[model samples]
Target: MLQRKLAALLILLPSSLSLTVTAQQQTPSNPVAPSQLALALPATASLSTEESHKPAFESSSAEGVIRITPAPQLEKELPSQRPFRTAAFGIKANTLGAGAELATPLFGRFNLRSGVNFLAFAYPFGIDGVNYNANLHFKSSQSTLDWFPGGHAFHISPGILYSKNTVSSAATVPAGQNFTLGDQSFINSVGDPVHGNMSLAYPRTLSPMLLLGFGNILPRNSRRLSVPMEFGVAYTGAATINVNLTGTACTNDGCTSFGGNSEVQASLTQEIHKINEDLKKVPVYPILSLGVAYHF
Candidate 1:
């Protein structure tokens, strides 16, 4: 009876009775084979593949974020100034403001220069102990030849200067000031100021000019830019000074008008004629200039 009971109990149980060990979140002793795991749990296999590549993806992302890259910088450029030329078309500036010239190499160490300078100015001066003021309206044209005897850096020039310079003034002498017009001493009526009109005419004829100069400001085969200086003189013709005199003056402390006297008037005319005689000694006009010029 015991044998039967044991057998019957055994039979009542399943034919293959074994405990199934399940680990949803634990690693197996031996890892699941790729083929078996794919068949058994496809999601598990896919999750394993994703986790295997996670470290590499993280490493790649880190490399992208933490990189030492040099920044690109930009630079700018500026234009350069040009130097002088050997033969050029140049513009020069001096006391005359502006003038244009053509500079060409003629014979060796020689250059021909021709240009004109003009200006209208008012100049006041004291000449031969006489105070004089005049408006200078002048135009001077030069036909000069430059000789670079001392190389290209220094030169001596000889030229013809045609000058059309004149002076005109409405002259007034202050009271108590004795002025010499022509060759006589004239005082404004002792207590009154005298007013008169005067004019001085200079020769417009061609005059001789001599100049000593330094530097070729225009670009040559050597230097590009330089400061040019020149000192010269022009032989101006005798000046003809004409004065129209009509004024009132007091004499002998009696306040008599001396301008109304025929004798005084005659004396004034004689004095006026003496101006040409007084200026007979001076006939040269000085020339000096510092200028900048550029070659083409």
Candidate 2:
């Protein structure tokens, strides 16, 4: 019995000592480092390693969650930096005749056109034996500044051509018929018949143009119809002729008074100085057009 009691006491003592040692060892040795478990989390469950690799239906607004993000795309304007947005209206023909035009857009590729043209006619002729009756008028007006270049439809213009062309005539010489002036030769007095009047003018009524074109009546995408064509020159100068005669003429030494003939007014001033030296060798005036346009 004594031995059994001693054994129990020793066992109890050992058990108590063991329990104390175990408690001391359970505190912590070295397993908690993900930066110490993210500092024991809870600053809203702290997560950073790039928010634990984002996109878990990514949210924000402090988790009241609201972030859609997909609107921001507006920047489009480059038809040569558009200007005067759009405008075009046209109708045309050529050689300064039937026309009506108006175009706008004056920036970048540049444009600005304007127009007006008209024509009138009536002619019936015979020159020398003189029996004319002509009347031709062609009014005009223009304004331009096109230049396309790289935005090409090919163009280049620079203009201003305002004219009111004319050519009037009304002459007859049938009483004994026969005529000629500078070189002198005439007849037509019987009952006085050799009345005359002639005119042709354009001493200069604004002209200074230069063009070269090929389609493009304000066209910068979204086409709204176009068809334009041009070729030009206009420096209108020298074109003036005027002649007037009353009646009575016949020379083989007889009737006279082509206004009291001083040799028929010096052969009508040498036939108006040889018809103004052949219209000063044409001082430009030739343009060609063709069109149909509409835009807005």
Candidate 3:
């Protein structure tokens, strides 16, 4: 029994030694170094230094914080859009007579306007004491600073009116025709035909104008055209009348072409007095105007 057992051990020992040699020849995929095994972890389960610093995406299974970065947008590089700033226009009986103006946007919700106007009209009339054929004329330049208190669509305008207001007249002591002086009618200065040239002017060339207006003649935000309306008062000073006489006045002899008679002078003075009374009723003029404007 002992001899048989010794032979069996010899055969198994050789086989076991051969298997050990084969395992040593092949390299281990998960070899453990001193540092890797220090934390009591398997070598195959350990992380590299770089891998340890990386953020983990697996929720709950990993312990780490992640950061996200956004890309830039192209729209932010585009230019900004803006509104209209200036305009030109033709205006009616407002600041300037019948003329034109230019408007420009000033600071916030304000507009500055400048322009000139001219107008002339003729009329035939007979007052109880006066005979007259006259032309009324107005020529002026104006400027305004407008404030849009409500909106750009409505405005309060205070302006400067620089104007020449006049009335040119021709009158004659009606030969056979009755002439009205004021309340007095004169067929002739004493009894002969008399002729005179008359002109009326305002003492002030500059006046104050205030108006409440509507419509954005030149619009900043709207794309359409606009029509504006303005109504106001112009404070024109007292009227001055000038009269020049020629040809026949009251004379002891009769009506003559050139008469320096005291009667002639007295007649002229009376006529002037009557005319002055007629002007006293008006001092402030009413202003109304309509305008169309376009912007670019």
Candidate 4:
């Protein structure tokens, strides 16, 4: 009876142990805590590549934001350079007026002249018979060619001039009678007796002249007054083709031939006679003048 009881108790203990092991294997493990999940999340990502490409600056308490690069500055240029200059020219004024250019180098090589001039002169009266007076009026239009030849000291100008001179006279005749007379009585040895005569004289003249001159310059600048001495010769002749006068005269010396009568010599009466006087024209002559010149 004791042996059987011990064996039954051992078998029952073994079965109970097996049952406890199986129950523990079927149970699930505990879930993780919410706080631990929050800690495991990735930190915020660094600035992206797109953001890094843009301009960037650092903010700080000690220094304000500083620009990393400045905008391109506009280029400046100076004005194009050129030389400064003043313009100039030469002009002259003279006695000849604005047109009257004294031969000077200011107006390049050529010169022009224009003006009015007055001439008053007297020449010896060529004849002895009567009284004579002469007056000349000169009007001129001219152009000149100047030759430098060397210095400004000298020049030559060839030109033309037109002029007029008037000559007039009056004479007293001696009182006398011709003996070729008995009713005709007024005749003498010479064509007519000049013993007593009175008459008026007239001479009118016109002349065209070719002139050439030589001058000596003292010294002057353009627009200044200068002294120049000029001498010129002119060939001039009257416009009238034939300028001649001829006349007959008779003179008696108190001797008479009255039919050869001799009665107390008849007061010594003279016979009438015939005489002739010839006056010729003067063809060409020379003229001289002196004057000053001005330049403006």
TM-score of each: 0.58, 0.39, 0.63, 0.36
lDDT of each: 0.63, 0.82, 0.68, 0.35
lDDT of 2 by residue, 33-90 (tens): 7887977776555434445666666664423444466678998774523666657899
Residue 234 of model 2 has an lDDT of 94
> Stretches of candidate 3 above 4 Å error?
1-85, 93-96, 180-185, 189-192, 249-259
Clashes of 4: 35
- Using lDDT as the measure, name the better of candidate 2 and candidate 3: 2
lDDT of 1 by residue, 1-296 (tens): 99999999898665434322334235466788878865786454445544565643232231132234556787432111121224544455545335555555555567776777777888786533335578878777787787888666788889998777778887666666666543445556645566667788876478998988897644346455566778888787677787665566544444334458676666667766676777766787777777665544
Which window of 10 residues has the lowest lDDT sum in candidate 3?
A: 76-85
Please name the candidate that would achieve the greatest TM-score relative to the true structure. Answer: 3
Descending-TM-score candidate ranking: 3, 1, 2, 4
Q: Give the per-residue lDDT of model 3 (tens digit) for 171-199.
A: 65566555443333344554446776788
Q: Indicate the worst ten consecutive residues by lDDT in candidate 2.
A: 59-68
| Order of the predicted models by lDDT, top scorer first | 2, 3, 1, 4
Candidate 2 residue spans exceeding 4 A from truth = 1-48, 51-59, 64-68, 72-87, 90-99, 102-116, 119-136, 139-145, 148-165, 169-195, 201-208, 211-262, 269-271, 274-295
Compared with the true structure, model 2 gives a TM-score of: 0.39
